[model samples]
Structures are given as C-alpha cells and as structure tokens.
Target: MTYELYYWSGIQGRGEYVRLALEAAGAPYRDVAREDGDRVLSAFGKGIETPSFAPPFLKDGAVVVGQVAAILLYLGDRLELAPKDERLRLWTHQIQLTIADFVVEGHDVHHPIGAGQYYEDQKPEALRRAEEFRNERVPKFLDWFETILERNPAGPDHLVGDRLTYADLSLFQVMSGLSYAFPRLMERLYGDYPKIAAVSAAVAKHPPIAAYLKSDRRLAPNEEDIFRHYPELDP
Candidate 1:
C-alpha cells in the first residue's frame, strides 16, 4: 500500500524528517499536500477519527499517525528501518526524540519571543538566543550524539546498531539543517564531533538517501523554514 503524507507545501520543516525515513527505506509514499495544496487544509479542517494536532501526519490505509517521531516509529517497524531487538528499538526512538528537541531549540533561536511574531520584531531577543544556542546548545546536542556513536557496541558507522536506522537518518537531517542554518558555527564545531560527522556523511552516501537529496523533491533550507539562516544570526 502506498503511504499518504500530509504536510505543508514549500518548506521542508518537520515533514522532512519523515521524508528522509521514507526515502531511505525506498518506501512508496505520496506527498499529498505537494500534489494538492488544499488537501492538507481539507483533512485538517474535517477531523479524522484520530485527528493530528497539526500537519506532517501520515495516512496508511485506515491508520493515521501524527508527529514526526511517532510517524517514523510506526513506519520503522514496517519499513525495517528500526532494530529487531526491542531494547535497541526503544533506544533508537529515544535518539529521535532527542533530535526532535534539538530541532525545536534550533528553531527557537530565530523566534525566541513567540512563533507568531516576526523575526524582525524580535531581532534583539533572537540575537541573544542565537548566541546562547550557538555557544552552548549546539555543542551540548552534538556532544551527546558523538558519545552515542562512540559508545555504540556495534560500531560508529550507525547510531543505534550495526545497520542503518531512522535515528541515523534523522541525525543526518539535523546536521544538514544545522550546517545550513549556522555554517560558521558548525564549521568550527563540527570537526570536533568526528563520529557525528561520519554518520552524516554515511547517511548522505546511502544509495536511496543520495538519490533523494539530488531529487527535486528535496526542498532547500530557507529563512521561512524552521532552520533559517540570517547573516546576523549566524555571526
């Protein structure tokens, strides 16, 4: 069965995480909103039995899964992107949740005051937040991922197990977004986290993921997206 994904058009946003997993697994899925913009609003307006709080929801037959981590968890088992061992599987989910937290923090750097308010309106606050995020939070999150890779009993090639998992894919996306959002900060800090860098490189080289990155389906990062790059913000 072809999976149906509902997310806002244009920006990659949180939807990209789910897209990366589906692409890595070579799953056949339809980007519903991309095909029909109105479909997202229609589905969201008319509530399903299990309505999602927002976009980036997935439709598989009758089952509707919401939230990036939840969607990946649901897809991981079926797509073989998750580990078979229950303990390792939960560990992978934990990693994805942490990544989700990192994404939110990264976004908050630009919109520190409120999501509804414009970045220009909160420029002063955003500048302060961005400095803290760049100096403290970025290294903190990257350090944890580096330790996870260094401690993985299997190897450092992947995040969870010897084989590829959704956690690794999600990490790659996070790294990519971070690099785009804060090229200067990452250029200086990324080298220190060689294991995290290795995972990002490996995921980019993965055949399916490589193809997806090159395809038109992959949207470029922009100021409007969660990972926005402002010259002042980065400086």
Candidate 2:
C-alpha cells in the first residue's frame, strides 16, 4: 500500500526530513498536504481520534504515526534506510532522537517563552535564546556530528558506514534548516566543520534528491517551524 504523509502545506518545516528520505529512497508515497490545497487544515480541524500531538504524521496501510522521529524510524526500517544490525539500528535511532532534540531547541530559540506566542511579542527573550543557540548549541551539535563522522571507520562517505542512512539525511536537513535560518551564524561556524558541510552538500546532489529538489513540490524555507530567519537574531 502507498504511504501517506501529512503536514503543513507551505514551508518544508519538520516534514521535509521525511520527504527528503522518501524521495531519496525512491519510495512511493503521497504528500497529502501538497496534493490537496486546504486539505491539511481541513483534516486537522476534524482532529485525530486520539488527538494529534503534532503534525508531520504518516499513514501506512493500517498504521498511523506522528512525530518526526517516529515517522522516520518507521520509514527507515521499511525503506531500507536503516541498518539491519540491531546495534547499528539502535544507534541510528539514538542519533535521530538527538537530531529531534536539536530541532526542538532550534525552534525554542525563536519561541523561547511560548510556541503559541508570536516572535515579535517574544523578541527580547528570543534574542537571548538565539544568542545561546548560536554560540553554544550550534557548535556543540556540529561538533558531535563531526566526532561521529571522524570516528566512522568507513571513511565518512555517509553518517553510518559507507551507505546513506536516514540519520545522514536528517542531518543534512538540519544543516540546511540552520543555514536558512542562521546564514551569518552558520557562515561563521560551518567553515570550521568541513565534514558536516560536505555531507549536507552531497545529500543535496544525490541523484534522486537532486531531482526532487528541482521539482516544485520541494518547499522552500520560510519563517516557520523549527527554522526561521530573524536578522536581529544574527550578528
């Protein structure tokens, strides 16, 4: 059965990770939000039977799952984007969860006080949060990945071993998200971490990814979701 993905229609937001992975794997799936305009809100208004904690949900056959990490975990296993070895599989999940945490922190830098509140309303607090994220969190996260890549005996052709995995794709998306939201800050930091940049650029140039990126369906970055550009938040 064909898989179905649901998320906000416009910006790629959190959903892009799943989209990029699916696209790269050449898997058959429906981006439901993009397929039917207004469908995202209409379905959302109807509400989930258990109440959706958040969006970027997926439906495959009888199973329905939400949360970006959960969706990717499911897809990674089924799409062969994850390792078959138990240890490596768990490690991949661990990294993916870490990436999820990083994404949440990035979002919080913009909406430090409240996700429900506007950025303008929380500008002062947001500025303080963004500064910390820029100077501290950004380097730490990048360094963590840098360490992982450096230790990989497989020579860093990808995040895990020599093949592409969901974690690498997610990392690529995170790198892109940060660059879009914090261009100047990334410019200052990314230069120091060559492996991270190389992997991100390689993911973009991957054949299937290159085609999907060229397609109109690939949404552009905007002021929403985990990443948002605020000039004042940058140097």
Top-scoring candidate (lDDT): 1
Clashes of each: 0, 0
Q: What tens digits encode model 1's per-residue C-alpha lDDT throughout 65-160?
A: 999999999999999999999999999999999999999999999999999999999999999999899999999999999998999999899998
Q: What's the TM-score of every candidate structure?
A: 0.98, 0.94
lDDT digits (tens) for residues 1-235 of candidate 2? 7888888888788889899889999999988877776467456536456435777888887678888888888998889999988888888888999998999898999999998889999999999998899989989999999999888888876778788899999999999888888999988887888998888889999999999989998888888667998889987
lDDT of 1 at 137: 94
Model 2, residue 57: distance off in Å is 0.8
lDDT score for candidate 2 against the true structure: 0.86
Query: Global CA lDDT of candidate 1, please?
Result: 0.91
lDDT of each candidate versus the true structure: 0.91, 0.86
Q: Which 10-residue span in candidate 2 carries the lowest summed lDDT?
A: 42-51
